[model samples]
Target: MSMTPPPGWYRDPSYPLVERWWDGTAWTDHRRQPGSVPVPLAPPEPAGHGPDRARAVALVAAGAVLVTSIVTGVFVLGRNDDGGGAAAVRTTPPATPSAPSGAAAPTGSSTAAPHSGAASVVVDELNGITLSLPKGWVAPSDVAEDDLVMTTPGTYDCPGDPGLCRHGTVASRTVTANAERSPKALAEQDIDDAANTAYDRDVLGGRPYRGITSHRLLKAGSVAVAGRAGYLVRWRVRTGAGPGGYVESLAFASSVGSESPVIVRLAFDAGAEGPPLTDMDRITEGIRPTGDTDTGGGVGSSIGPSR
Candidate 1:
């Protein structure tokens, strides 16, 4: 027989000074990794896993030194009409496994619309999509029709009672659809421009990437998506630690339709800690245009990210 750790933040078994989420049931996507704020302890548990998030540059080997100039050179420009809190999986990307030192990232059992802090399962009706989201991962009220933002649940460094995670999009996800480059090129470009470097340094830090180590494209290749062309990438970047972000990302993109060159993506901040995500690939692979994208074809149809 096995004993499960009580629901709360605990010291990540893999990394020191990190915290993980155990929502009274299973491990979650929340982490308090290497460079997060003063790690807060979870409900009566030790700091078993920390909650930290990261992002960076392009085409460089994972975790190598990258110059800010290079990031600016090939970085994807322009932001889509986004809601906020972008987050990741597939091949799937590499990550610390699930917790209680053994359990896996749990699959939610809710089929109803999310309310407050319960686990939510939301479907994009216009797109024929189904998302098995974490508790509090609900579409934002101000979300655009083409974009989606969900409330991420995790224990933050904030002093709080036990068995609770008040953190929302501080480490969140943004999924949007539009005519960007193809999945391959767009995956490469998204890293350099914002996802890894700028978003962390400029936007979050009120400055620029410290350029300690070059952001890394750990892996990139093709995936099998249902009704669309799919490409997957794994990025290793330390977007905010001023050195190397203790972050791991698994980004997936799809070029829908045979007429136009359009791309849809699952993007976000994932920490390099235990209790990693599960079933994310199935979620990404299941995406479609709600019908069909009348694209022009080819991976070079556009210049930069959609404005």
Candidate 2:
């Protein structure tokens, strides 16, 4: 006997947007309350004769009223099949439960799930080149064997002749020392004296390699590496193709944690035309001491001898 609105009726549009009432087959005065039961319309009188006809009419009217109420509620709930109703529903998705106060939202489905865009830093034990790589990046065995490392969108290729390596190429080399040598002396030898060196040249996959023209020093800094004091020097150099291509070279040296007295790293990049200082900072930041090191390494090593 509850009275609900007809198929389409609105009592208030700005606030609660309440619905009007329906009485059997027509509108009625049975008003609805905020939390009270709805009142149905007055019933029809009994007809003459058997009274069966009146009962049937009344039943039909009641059925119509119930059906109209259901349809009206569904339409009001924004579940109508009309295009506008669908659009409204889409714009207003189901409300999401709020998280408890001061609790961080859950991360990446589960703790086991790897975070998107997460990069793991891997340091090469031999050359000490640290690579920041995504989970999917494949580390080639050959480069690992050669003590060379690179990130995705990059690959390391060791040449029988490293001097002829191509553009965008990065290369490194090892050198021997007479005695325990500090990183500063080795860096100076590589940059100023050009001794015990490795060079990178420009080469495209299917194109001939180009030659370098001039080499100029840009910036120099000192950092610790692998439990020993180290020095880092960067340089800007010209290429063989006239005034276009350039090269960046970073050389680092440090004692190899009680293994070797000193370990030297000479990294070069071909086809880099920017100021030498830019790549210098990048390569310097990549150098990290594996163990505790002296703050300043007691000044740079003298250039007297390799030892």
Candidate 3:
């Protein structure tokens, strides 16, 4: 520890233009510049002086302690060579927090881009899928297995609701990287599943009309989606009361980039046998990945589920 100066006035070593009070161990904020009249902290007690002089010295010492204790703040604006030359003041810098080492910054694009499907009639920006759904079709909330559900508004004869139904639903759930099936096999399997009663009961939830009477794979062929060779199969399904219903279904299978090989099934059946879908060609032809970058993929699905 350095030697403590006696508690008294001394010229400040750092600033030659001023004198400061050394409170022994530390430098006090009390300061004075040259050519200024100095205030004697303790006036000399005349030989005849007694209790009165001693009391005055005590009051002066107490005042100095009060001034130093109150000034805890730092960096009070000081007048340099200009005029506002106030006394010396103590100041300290504020502390701030910082990030720790080796932390990775946040990222935006974590999902793989689709190799094709950029030209679809509509696009689901989040899942990198494009669609050519019918007009008045709206995507609903609560999508399962990342599937896209499109619902078209219309009137239909239904068992549950008391009024005419105005909702026709279709879904396409793409399974990527299924090692158990090739593209052709995947397409065939999906088409076959579409024809089954289970797919109707579970997927349809008895919407529009129920009671599937028949389902069959109508055609299977090789096609290209996003410049990648894939297989497509058309399925014909029949549902409802007597002869029930009939609708065409399509399934596609292909590899999605470095990800696993993917197979997609897009199906529609309007409770009853719905007529041939008018927007099918545009949607299928427009299938391409929305490229590697995306802008704003917000809440809600593009097309809603069967309502």
Candidate 4:
């Protein structure tokens, strides 16, 4: 006695701001803003069996509520599709189950499948750069307020307290507030802020990792990133609560010809539960300019470990 919703637009299960096509039997790829015209479904076959059509429509409608609830809850953790300019360092926990606030949602699906091989590039059009997303890492789910943030699969309870935490995160964006043009100087200057943002406290005033107590420089020197000259500073920091982690600040010139300095911050918790530390070097070496493939100066050199 159940009825299926006919072929029409329904509220998108993944994002609440828009609607997606729900075909006579299942969901379709078509999506549009709330009030925009819906994409027309394909023409029906010539006078198909009346019972078959009716059955299909019934199935679609019958499962509509269940599918919507499941999909919405699964992808509700950390979804932010806002396209904004550079801002101060802000580390917030994974968004709550409620729909995240932002401008227009992204046009494509919100699934955060892991990338590999040639398709592993994570393009950050906002910063005009791209980085190779490692095998276990997925695209940004708005874990932090950076232009782009690629993180490991899921989150866990922070050892410091009861909040959720991601063991690994790599964030990138252009440096608009600072006037420094030297990559080395910028990298050194930003390391402290990076450590604090990642470990000290979140925007909600929660001390997830408690706070950074001390840090030791692990690496500092010139290098190349995104086809531009850059410098990186890595530190092994100790936190007041949980096992501390590694933080790296890399500064380079933008490949978009604006010469604006770009910064990439990396944070990885130390322990077996966290991602492999080697991922740091791999990610740094995989950065490339988004569009132009001129290979400005090859991969160039890398920063060596220091005391």
**Alpha-carbon lDDT of model 4:** 0.60
State every prediction's TM-score relative to the real structure: 0.39, 0.37, 0.42, 0.62
lDDT of 1 by residue, 1-307 (tens): 2233457554443322334555755555454322322332322222334432111101223553322211111012223334322232111112222323334543321112224543334433322333445433444321111233333323222111111112222111233444454656655544443444323432212233333245565556654443445455545565433233322222333332233332233333344421233323434433343333332221221122221
| Cα RMSD of predicted structure 3 | 32.3
Tens digits of per-residue lDDT, candidate 3, 188-245, equal: 6555444442223432233323545666645556655544555666655665532333
* Local distance difference test values of all predictions, in order: 0.34, 0.30, 0.36, 0.60
Instruction: Quote model 3's TM-score.
Output: 0.42
Worst 10 residues of 2 by lDDT: 70-79
Model 2 lDDT on a 0 to 1 scale: 0.30
Better of 2 and 3 by lDDT: 3
Judge candidate 2 at residue 194 and give its lDDT.
28
- Candidate 4, superposed: residue stretches over 4 Å from native: 1-118, 142-144, 293-301
lDDT of 1: 0.34
How many residue pairs collide in each prediction? Answer: 45, 9, 21, 2
Model 4, span 1-307: residue lDDT tens: 3344466666555443335555555544343333433322222222245565544421123323321111111011112223212642323233312232222323334322233422465676656676776667765542323344567654444656434566778877667666789999988988877787678765445576777889998988888787678888999989888788898888888767586887888988887866788888888888877666565432635565575
